[model samples]
Target chain A: MNPIRWLVGRFPTLALARRNLSRATLRSALAVTAVVIGVVAIGAIGMGGEAFKQDQLEAYEGFGGTATVEPASYIEEGNLTNTELSDGDVDRIRQAAGSATVLSVHEPTDALVQTQSGTLLFRAQINGLANPGEFYETRNGTIPDNWRQTVVIGSRIADQNDLEPGDRLRVNVSDEFDRNFEIAAVLRPQGFSAPLGADRTVFVPTSQFESGGYEQVIVRVDTRTGSIDGASQAIEQEFNAREQVVRVEQVQEQREQFTEFFSTVNQFLIGVGAISLLVAAVTIANTMLMSAIERESEIGVLRAYGYPKRAVVSLLVAESTILGVVGAVVGAPIAVGIGMAVNQLLLGDPLAFTAVGIQYVGLGVAFGVVTALVAGLYPAWKAANKRPVEALD
Target chain B: MAPAPGDDGVTADVTGGTVPTDEIIRGTDVVKEYETGGQTVRALKGVDFGIAPADFVAVVGPSGSGKSTLLNLLGLLDVATSGDVRLRGEDVSTFTDREQTRKRKETIGFVFQSFYLIPTLTALENVEMPRMLDRTPTQTRERATQLLERVGLGDRLDHYPDELSGGQKQRVAIARSLINDPDILLADEPTGNLDRDTGDRILELFDELRTDENVAVVTVTHDDYVAEAADRVVTLIDGRVRETEDRRANFEEGPDT
Candidate 1:
């Protein structure tokens, strides 16, 4: 109890440490900023990778429908770009199936969009019509009635033009002389549905899209609702006599890729954060070592005055921990906020950062503090061990 | 410069100077050495010494004359390479670091030459440090106040070391050493850095402290005037014991062992 009281009473004495820091405040602040910049850099990398993976996941899950399959042939090629699957293809596959319900779908489009501000003149898959409302259902907005020069524009184009609900945009699909489009309505932002800011999305009605052209057929089979592969195989054998324009999929790999991509990205960023923290640890160690050197005489006096060696060590370690904790308090929140802001700017949408977890922030502080404490240990102990009679000289 | 055999050299040959042989501390065959710049320097070479209860003794020596080394060894701040340093007749050489610290805390008080009060602490806090470390809170406040009052800085308790004069800082140092109430108070060149007037006042405080507390006082000083203030003076030369001057010559040495 008395020792505690004494330490508290002498807390003012320990605060002389601040005067010690003020002599070289700029250098100390620079050291703290080094850790801050590292954290910010880590947050930035985490944000960019989040954007890329989200885009890829949306592209993958676009294959979601009532009964989905990806055949070995269509395993890699999503939404074949240069072929056609007609009602004849559905009829032949149905005739081939006995006692099985079958729907062979192939959505095609040759529509273009022109925007007032800017546009992405890339190809968009005309997703199959078994789930026609999937686009309007998965994403919120009005769907086009048919393929016309008029098109529903993506929000990216709207944002670029500074346009809103009643505004119309013009966009060209491929080259400047290709088909131009006038936007009748703009779509809402749904994750990464439209390729980021700048839109040339033309979602035409299925019939209008089929009237233009398409690449592959999706063969859906309902063998008692659970045996999709049976009808799929019979259709495949029938198509074996023809060119392999159709494919089957397990329907879950699309979602699996999303989980895997995010998990992989999360693991990679955490690894980088850990490595950066390790470097910060070294920085803390160096700082404490230099500070100890500067305060050796002060330490000697404290020891000479009957301060137990244990007390001296604890004082030094506690001082360093306070430094690290103060630095972290200044850094982590700024990083989280900066991450959110940059994501909102570049992705034109809010980006949530799971890069710095609460546990990780705690770990970062521990890393920094432990580093400084360890570095200060030997020096503090040496100070305590100095012979008072010798050191007074 | 070697003293007569069997005579511990710190006692001065003057009126009322010789100390009683049986005392709280005894140093036998004490030797201290240091390696300075790759050369072995012997500081205290087999210096025999003794201090009796309530004796005010001053160890006087020139620079490089081992006075400080002997002080350090006596204060338990450093170890003598080959010596038997006893506390109350028990050899303290083999004690653990904790044991040594406990001994020092309980039995030793130190006043440094430079007035090594903790700079951040006020005069009161500086006096209060050891008592706090030793966990003697109840007596700490009253004793510190009384000692400060004795040193004539009772009103300046809250003033920091830098705010005080050199003598004031030494007085605070003196107050701190007494706060422990040790068997012996050791002052290492306590007045070295003070002006003559401040030095005289500090020595006067030591005298008053001696008269009031009956505590054994050992002061190591380079100044002849400082040594003259003590009842006994011990001289050291080239790491060896020299003359032990009894400042006030005694009729007989007490009960020679």
Candidate 2:
């Protein structure tokens, strides 16, 4: 025999419930539709939120091993002094960060750029790294190994000024020194949280800075060979062993903040979804109450024939549960399909569904069943507690 | 211990004789009351009744005579306010709710005037319902089939209640009542909705069940033909047993016997 048939034969209450629900096809269908809507709302929203969060987290993928070490401001002789990191500090950071590349970045300076639009004066962030090729990708031109007397502009600056590689431009640094140099390259636009604020910045050789102290030390660790946490801890210990001298900010911390933010958003969305399920629960309660009222005499007949109160309750609850199961079974796959579409829309990968997303579907289905069961409880109890004599009369 | 007929404190003996030892069910001094609209109304006032095995008893009474109330009490569907209702020599009040349900399922079957067949279930499934409560479907399937065939519903076993006529529905109910092989079948106005021909056929089926299946049949009805067909008729008036007419002696000596 088929498994469902065997199950129905084994549990006659289930069989009766199935038959009873089928008796009012339209009512049962409407009830099931309500549950389906609830399940779809919960599951699809949960899954879509998860996919969005994952996509956001993926944007921070390559920056996980990056950390920025900046000198913390200290009071010196009754005056607040924001000191620059010395060469010794850079050496210590490099030593502490095992198998990591350390680069010193100069403080931003107000500069006048000769663009086709005009001579625009803006605060331009400057990097004084020896090798820019290791940290940045160029969109228009390449950075030479022996890069000297040349400047690399960020994509934002290039786009704003219509500047290109090999273009000759004069930049006045801090209104003190000026030089005309060929633009070596236009760097690609890094995302919002990129170290050194790569966008809206310019790259120059360390020889151009003339200062011995560095404004910021950028450390990039190869996660395969070294741990970012270990590097951050070592850097912090080396600089602030006795007092607060340098502040270490790991990319992981920002990622953690983003994750927390997304988690909160996911919960809120799921809560919104649960409200729909609550409405579905009320619908189920109303449907079950109506069915109990309609079947009062039949229930009395069952009671008179020796069905216990629990049996009557069980029969009614079974009907509701069947509605739940049917709705959830139908809704889960549709929600999954919706999730896939959301993933495709947001993440550009239809198969980017995470295990957590699938778990949300399961959670939605479980909630749907639980909601139906709870909704049916009162009606079942009321029906079961009815006096057979009163019902028959 | 059985209470003496008239000597019992509650009510005089309406059976006009001593309680039989082989009685399947007995009620002594049964009083049932209900609070309706802030006033207490006694549905059955200290009434004594009994049913022996294979007995065909009809309870005939006018409206407000507590015929259905007595049937409800006898079927274990309701409890008496003050009385001793015994089944198979055991006091019914001593049984817990679950035990009462078990006893009712195993020993007594109930039929209703409305037939009360589950509209969703087929004739065979309806017959199998009581046995299904015992959770032995494989064992009772053949019995349900046999009972439906015996009730002349063999061809209509798969037909739902809505598809069956009044007489056919009543026959299905009669078959369902016998599915558990109950010693007593309590029916409240079993033929109240049927025509004269259908009612007569149902009464005949009751007679055949009592004689051939050895099941006692107790029906509460206002139909005189039903009262005439019974081996005994108990008349109730204003919540009290008015008379008990014994026709079993005449029935056994009749031409059919």
Candidate 3:
């Protein structure tokens, strides 16, 4: 049997409802349009939020396998005690880090640099590692295998001063320590989660910082075989086990905090979308109520013909449900299109829809159907309960 | 007055004594009241009415004479306020709403003055409606087609009520009422909306239903032609039965007599 014929045979009220809705084509179209707008609002907002969160999450990628161990300030007697990490502390961190490369960083210093615009002064972070090749990548030149007097400039400072690899720059730490060094390379811009704000720093050999203990230690875990969390925990235990000596901050923790914050923001945006659906529900209620009132005499004829009240209610509800289903089904793909556009605009990948984004589309469809059902209830009940004689009159 | 025995062996004692076995519907001292703006108004005051198989009864009265109220009680569309309305020897008041709906669907059919054909549905679908209520549309499809053909609407079966003429709509309604094969067909002013020629055709169709289909038809009308064509006419005046006339005898005796 044909499915429509079979369905009509089984649920004759549905056939009646379909025909009744078709009788008022413009009104029905308007009601269905309301539902479509509601579904699109919810699904599109939810998908857009998901795409934004994913984009932010991608920025935190590649930084997870690194941790920065810095000296923690403590109160001793009546004074604040801020101490630097010593060579002994670096040795202990290397021991606990287990296959992780440890590079001690010097305290950042204020230096005057020679620029095309003349000598300018700014605070520059300095790192003096034996093998900087393991921790940094160069955009224009390579890191030398041997330690040298040559220095590498960070991308931000290099761009500001028109300096790159092979450029000769004069640095004045003080009147007593002024020297000219060749710029070996311009380092790549490590994103916002970079440990020591590496984008604006300069890197030199350890001979430049030969006077004091290290300011911080950077542990680059072998992400392919080692865990950053394990390395961070081990280094913290080694340095701060007996006293508040070092603070271990893992880049993975920052990523997790970013994810949590975006999740809350996505929920808030979805809540805002649900309000539009509530307004659509009110429009559906008004439409159904008006339909019921206009069909009073027709309903009376059905009741007098012995249609049960439940059947009358079913006919009206079926009409609203059809509107909801058509609206939701049509809205789902449009929402997906909107989601793809958002992803393409924000993340540069059109198909970067997350599972949660698709789930939100499904949620919008379900909410649309439920909203229409709830709105139709009172009208169906009121119409069904009218006495046949009164309705006929 | 008591109804005389028909050829089908059905009789009704409308004088309120013993219940007849073959009466399709009977209303005994049926009273109906309504509350309008804090005032109680009696619509029907103790009217006794009954119909047997193959009977054509016309209820005629002025406006507000309770003819429609009596028709409503007899059709099981409304319950009598203080009297008994019975269908096939069972009191309708004793039935639950579901049972009443089932009994009404199975035992009675209704035709309204406005024709009341669902404007959205075609003539055939309107005819199939009563069976559709029973979830038996497939089973009723052939029968519904035959009914439309019988009512001279086979070519117009696909036409909606709006596309149909007033007489055509009434014909579709008549076919719809017969879909359930009910014993009683209650029509409230079935010809009220038609012209004289169309009204006469509808009256002829009612006569054919009474004689050929053995269906009892009770029409409430103010039209004199409808009352004159019925086997019996019950006239109501001021919520009470003023008189009951047997017109079958006059038809049998010829017009000159």
Best by TM-score: 3
Instruction: Provide TM-scores for the models.
Output: 0.73, 0.78, 0.81
Q: How well does candidate 1 score on lDDT at residue B54?
A: 62
Ranking by lDDT: 2, 3, 1
Pick the winner on DockQ between candidates 1 and 3.
3
lDDT of 1 by residue, A1-393 (tens): 467555654563354444345546776676566566555545445555565555545554543432332223343456634255556665675676555444433332433443454554454332333323334331334445553544454555456555554444443223222443444566655444221111333443333332433333343333335455565567678766577655644344445755676768776885686576557656656776676666565565556556667766766665555555556767667655665665565555664444443344445445555554565566556656665555566
Name model 2 segments beyond 4 Å from true.
A1-7, A71-217, A222-243, A256-275, A345-348, B1-17, B244-257
Off by over 4 Å in 3: A1-7, A70-218, A225-227, A346-348, B1-11, B14-16, B133-135, B246-257
**Top of the candidates by DockQ:** 3
For residues B169-210, write the lDDT of model 2, one tens digit per residue: 998998899888898888878888789988877877777776
lDDT of each: 0.60, 0.82, 0.81
The local lDDT score (0 to 100) that residue A174 gets in candidate 3 is 49
lDDT, residue A124, candidate 2: 59
**Number of the candidate with higher TM-score, 1 or 2:** 2
Score chain B of each candidate by TM-score. Answer: 0.83, 0.87, 0.90
DockQ value for model 3: 0.55
Instruction: Give RMSD (Å) of candidate 2 vs. truth.
Output: 7.3
lDDT of 2 by residue, A1-393 (tens): 577756767888988998899889999999999999989999999999898787767656867798889999888899878768888888888998878999887764455656534565364566666677778789989898888889888888888777899886676667345777788999877654567667777787777766677888888888888888899999888878998889998888888987898889889989999898899899999999999999999998888778999999999999999999998999999999999999998788988999999999999999999999999999999999998889999
Q: Is candidate 1 or candidate 2 better by lDDT?
A: 2
Q: Which ten residues in a row have the lowest lDDT in candidate 3 chain A?
A: A108-117
| Cα deviation of A132, candidate 3, in Å | 9.7
